[model samples]
Target: MPQPSVLIAGAGPSGLVLALVLLQNGVHVRIIDKERTHRIGSRAAGVMARTLELYAQLGVLNDILAVTSPFGPMASYDFGELVPKSKTAFLFEHQEPTPDIPYPNTEAVNQTKHEGVLREHLAKLGCTVELAAELRGFEQSAEGVMAKIMHTAEDGRQNEETATFEWLVGTDGAHSVVRKQLGLSFLGETRTEHVVGLGDIVVEEGLGMDVAHMWFINGKMILVRPDDVNNKMFSFLYRTSSAEKPLTREDFVEEFYRITGRRDVKFGEATWLSKYTPNIRMVDTMRKGRVFVAGDAAHCHTPTGGQGLNSSVQDAANLGWKLALVYKKLAPASLLDTYAEERMRVIAHMLGLTTALGDTNRANMGKKDFKMQHPDAMRMLGVNYRGSSIVCEEPGAAEGVDDPYMGGVGGRVQAAYRAPDASELVPAGKQDKTTRLFEMFSASRHTVLVFGGDAGTRAPVVKALEHFPATGVIHAVLVLGQGNATPSDAPSFATVLEDRAGHAYKGYDVDTGELAVVVVRPDGVVGVVASDAEGLERYFKKILIAA
Candidate 1:
């Protein structure tokens, strides 16, 4: 029998990230792009601090981080040029909220730089981005999804081929072919006021080009970041003067002066300069049976606040784990539907925020004082879907209960939850205190989270753990108060660990008044936040063992 297939459309960062994440779990995927080559322009440059941490978790931290520039001590001025220097007048600073995870520094990485990182990562997974390929037709059934694709080779001959898989994903950008085939409606309005200009160019120095140089003037802006990967080239994003003017090489340079008060700067060779109407769009739906859409295919955030790339990458990460589980038959089909629901909800908020900020940019064109400084905007990087079916939120989970984003890497690795001795786990070779015990657990099997130390809770939890030993490998944990357990009494409570002074509960950042047990899914998300550990055994035996 042939292996399972995942047909991914679009080789942009999000699509490529999805393919790489899925491939890490040994899933077979074929990533396709309508463009014959990777885009080298600086389309999206703002990589959120949270996204950088995700990449670090994925094991590509050293490779990508080495080439990327550090964006700190940065400034955002109201009356001067927004250039990267040793010092600055305007401070558009972004800082990590929690010290445990400190890599939340977002530098200006162009789409080209990031795409190179993603492409390199994808290659390591034995998958290559297929260029000059387009999806023409596809169909889904109870069994799987079948895709009809057309490929054009170096010979320029177009060949039609068929790919059948249990699942198909549309990452094919705003004008997604996969989305169109699925008839998913892009439900949002296009903004009409300002024209967003983006291009790649090498400028003649002394216009103050020491660090990443940006000019915030004349109600317009230009972001010039260094891209050594492309021969020390600097990419730019400036606002177009009017909608009527067609963006050409000459127009792109002339407009920069008209806005920034500099006309003597000789702009070097040009790559791709696009003039967009700054539209915001999102699909009314993201999933249809075996077919799903992600990234711009799902929702197009206004590109002002830099949420588009990170948001898309987060969508891939959220859907990657679930898709891996369901594709492997470890979860029910209904669980796959949650991808659209969860991501659609997130992208909607991103779009709303980005649109509001874009309006702010258009409004502040004269003063040139456009700055995106929303703290809530950073929340997208750390989003988790406790509401999804695959996640079993505990009973009476508080309405609007903020989920502590924690997941184990299938081991005894500690989660960043507050531990009695957080100071002990600091320098374990790139390991931080944030590596929680939750992240160390293998999410492939439903792990039983036994909360309390009482006989009522421990008895049923132990029984279920033993019962599901073969059915589901259960990692029985005892989140007791500090000094609750001792080695001398180890045999009496064979699998119990002292709560470390109620530190585990506090560390995991969970409420621990009297909840007897909690069951965690393989993904380190709460599966069954048990009401009282009542019907607890049946939950394992009935809902889970059978579920």
Candidate 2:
């Protein structure tokens, strides 16, 4: 009998990522796509720093960054002249290193190219994206999820196969078959007033194709960024009405002229042109019993601020670990609800923001103040789970105090709270900080930041964890800043940094005197915040242990 596990539908960025994660953590996953063969379709160009951190955990970030470099800087254009380059210029990084936000800013590469990199990684994990197999129907039961997948064989044959798994995830694009099959309602609008676009073309030599250049030509906006991997191939984002229906190669040419104000532009060839009528909508619920939805299946919107693909990738990251726990029997399956509950807010927010940005396109606002908590800023990595059922109904939601990204809701103010004592987790007399621990912990899991001194005081926490390791509960980190050499019983060990001068602690915003801890889920969202190890333990029991 096949193992009861996850059934992931739609192999877009989110679905494919969910497959990679589950397989890595020992969960069996079968991913099916509606299309017969994967086509290098549209470009989902923007990748946020937090998403990059998730990719780093998946272990392909370095390779991804290497393949997509040397894209000139990000430039704003006034008329035909270039303004100052953007601070977030690095294709694969926002800022190299920052003590506040562990992740970098955001990165950009065509969706086709990015998807290719993901496919390569997925192949290495003993899973292949089964093309042509479409999820046409599914039945969810307490036992497992059985899906009817339709596919046409290479011999020009047609077949329907029923596959059974413990759970099903829909990652299909905007018009999701799984959503329709489940009778779920996608609540929102398909009101598109202007036409948005994307295409790959060659630019005039030394037009500074090295930098990601944006031109707000009159009211239409043009965003062009060179693919570091291929100089001849550059991705362009703009609005056009050159064609009443779908724009063509000539339309792209004319639009480029309209924006660049230079009809002298010539191109060698065209790779892809995709036109999307912005539909800002999200499913009423991301989860219904054993079936779940993600990515475009759960939420899609106008590509105005470029948050659709970023948010979808984030949804994948959030669900991957939780679903793994379900498969491992570490927690009751109900724990999976957190995926929908937590990610729904993200999707809803994106839809709201994108819709607003779409409305403002006629005015063509420049830059939109990256610092402002404008909905479009969600394009950066600032999602949270403060009001989540998994957040233990913590007291801070009203004032917006405790959730991760405490910097402020909608990413308003960054985590401005810094500790007075920079060396929070170092031994008193010994020059040891938890820098290595932070690096290693950040490498794999979104670490639990323990702040109170001598975490061993809460020995019962370790006992509880050891007692429930089979239950598949929360992963714990023992943070000790000022005092200790060892942990008595609990999983308490202060961060031991390479240099004890407190450089690393300062890097992550941990102060010696602050007696607080943050529960960071695998997807990098802060699940809970507490005063001490006991609070941390309470969070573990609440969110991690048996459903």
Q: What's the TM-score of every candidate structure?
A: 0.78, 0.82
At residue 435, what lDDT does model 1 achieve? 39
| Model 2 lDDT tens row, 194-239 | 6677777776454555567666545557777776434566677777
TM-score of 1: 0.78
Name the weakest run of 10 consecutive residues (lDDT summed) in model 1: 418-427
Best by TM-score: 2
Whole-model lDDT for model 1 versus the true structure?
A: 0.62
Worst 10 residues of 2 by lDDT: 412-421
Deviating ranges (above 4 Å) for candidate 2:
1-4, 70-96, 204-206, 229-231, 242-245, 258-261, 364-376, 393-396, 399-438, 442-452, 455-458, 470-475, 482-499, 503-517, 544-547
Most lDDT-accurate candidate: 2
Per-residue lDDT value at 537 in model 1: 58
